[model samples]
Target: MSAPANDRLFRRWTSRLLLSAILLGVCHPLAAAERPNLVFILTDNHGAWTLGCYGNPDIRTPQIDRLAAEGIRFTRALSSNPVCSPTRATFLTGLLPSQHGVHSFLGGERPSAQMGPDAYCTIREFASLPKILKQAGYVCGLSGKWHLGANLTPQEGFTSWITMPHGATTEFYDAQVIENGAVRKEPKYLTDLWTEHGVRFIEENRDRPFFLYLAYNGPYALGRLLLNPARNRHAEYYADKELLSFPRDTMHPWQFHNKDFLNNPTSIRRVAAEISGVDDGVGEILQVLQRLGLDEKTLVVFAGDQGWMGGQNGLWGMGDHTRPIGAHELMMQIPLIFRHTGRIAAGQTSDLLVSNYDFLPTVLSHLGLSDQRPPQSPGRDFSPVLRGETTPWENVAFYEMENTRAIRTDGWKYVARHPEGPCEVYDMQADPQERFNQFGQPAVTDKQRELAAQLDAFFARYADPQYDLWKDGRSKAGRLGGAAGPAAAPPQRP
Candidate 1:
């Protein structure tokens, strides 16, 4: 009787233990999905003011506008660099171009040769964004322009990539594309192709948490045509005739040279059309997420690589550092939107001073991953702000071009140039347009000196180690195939 009773009691206890173990296993954090799927949609040279949600009355970007309406839009976002390749490098490596060393566009073999060995041979030392995410068990994919380097594939973390070796021209039809490593011809529009690959990547990885980097080459260029060309049909249809009636405002005295080109009716129309095309492409991606039922569990980010002058401040393109081109907010400010259906709050705006370098840390924080060891990057996670747990940021956003650097705080912007160039300070609250220069004003000299010291310290800590291009005598002139002079010749209009 004792042996039978003891055996029955042991069996009951064993069964209870097994059931409890199973319940705990199901409740474990690791047993659930590790992290949300991340979809980063980046556009090239798209200004913040070009979208409908950004208050551009001429352009129709319903899809991007919808993302803004459904997510959080940072009104004062910026890029580390004003150019494409350097800024893209900053976003990928979480280090500024001065640190990563790819400070200019990887246009083609010829340009690479002209730039010298440092520009041609520098590989990123820090972990790229995809690599970091991929190491954390997320499948990574990239589509569209890979302007970082011409020969490099998606080696760090991207499991699959369809990127153009050279910058793709803004063409709605018969655009050239590179798949993986080989060049492939694609007949569809450039934006459509980019979105297509992004959607396909999501479809393929629906079962696993994935990161899709869709870089669209749109509204940036209409095949070397500056500020939009007459050939752009979409711009023609969407052009706001009333806005066209206003006089063109050139920011710098030198910018008057490009006023005619900026005011050309054909160019304005083309620019508007190209932006519309990009908007449609964004819509396609949102539709795909909805159809796949992955909307709620996915975090979608829409950002521009850098800002464009678009005839603002009298500059036709970026890299005109002779004047205060890159220092202006219009040339450095970018639009940033993060949307997560139920996870993130909808339709909010953050005026916090944030930059592209903050992207990697933000993504890692959102995934609840531990911060990487050694503190290899300068960016900080803004997840607290995104979660509605914090108020405005206490930091200032920094900006850099070849030999120029600037810092923007909440109410004041301080900029300094190298080797005795003009230093300017602007009261943003009083002059958002930056028309007046206040560097010599006795009232703000102390504040200006403080900001300059901060900028100097920042450069000492974060600027590129190999060579301080800003301090060195070597100039960016003749670097972009333009003449070596005080000012590079503006692009010729057709």
Candidate 2:
């Protein structure tokens, strides 16, 4: 059969299956119109501060900014962990790193050895977002960057999977990619290709409820990747401009890597170009939804897997870029926007403290599947807030990165290291830049003790015994050097 013929046949078959499922009473009884489709656009290593909607005047992200204008932009949305894999796992499973056992990024040095011969799916043991949605009769599709191990095959109940050959990106052009169980080098820009696949998925599944995980691994401004000038479509536009949004502060004393890229114009332009590339993709996806008349029927979510720091505090990478693994506000904050024409409120900003852990429950609740939420999840449902309701909310958020843990309240931020003497206490209201550490100061000792107790109690309630580092627990994946370089592992529990 010809390629076009095969595609037609496949679409017809899927359409028939969808119709049959509905007739057979497999779908919800509330009718297809009530069950909204989900289009989750997840970006990589991007910060909320880089977008124009987040108050960055230098970078151009008109499409994402437009989405924020039409929906709710979270001012305090943060990631549970500050790395790639751990935060991604938390986003899917709604479990913290201590519970999910993914303490750090996977497939680092021992890509093959870490996952073993068969290639394990790290989050397969948990009840993830995709699996829950699939069971609820939504056709799930993943477009890019499935870094949760087993990139070869679709994990977590996804039917359509097109992902990178590896988690990290060395170059965006002519990069290795995996599609239909085969690894090949893609000549096109990776972001565009993912968008193409995502558009196709939306078109084909328009007749039924679908979930598209349009994961873009772009704007990844880290490592030697930023050493060269960007070759994307937006390269020339940013080549001559001096983006003043990025701070020109001196190198941070805690920065242990990417020293040369600090305050470099070429690096700055490259990051801006990549971010614009992602913005282009977002624009394309939104256009398709409007063209197909599915704008109101689909709940469009734009978020980042984790946050990135572009020279803020002289830090060019994420929290793990530092030896002690700093968890500054910039490193933890991410871009979170939700849009559904008549459902979610438009042109609003919420200051409630939210994290990636809250994503799964909030999504489930928003879709009217609150009963399907996993039990004992630390995440609380924020669906009421999304609907523009005035509800009581907890004003605290906690973070964990291997040996370091931190707690953020409305006014104070306390950081605790394992078995350590060097700790930090910052009065965020007084010194938002976190310049002064009041850890041992007598004036804030009582506040510090109170925050510490709350932090300890929260972790004690949720941290799994097998993966709690403070209690000498072991990690399930490759860990960063953390307090020790990038290769040292934590001490094992007896």
RMSD of each: 12.2, 7.5
Per-residue lDDT tens digits for candidate 2, residues 10-71, read 35544554464466365457554458999999999989999999999999999999999899
**Superposition TM-score, candidate 2 onto the true structure:** 0.92
Candidate 1 Cα deviation (angstroms), residue 156: 2.3
CA lDDT for candidate 2: 0.85
How big is the positional error of residue 43 in model 2, measured in Å on the Cα after superposition?
A: 0.7
Least accurate 10 contiguous residues by lDDT in model 2: 485-494
Error of 1 at 184 (Å): 3.6
Quick one: best lDDT, which candidate? 2
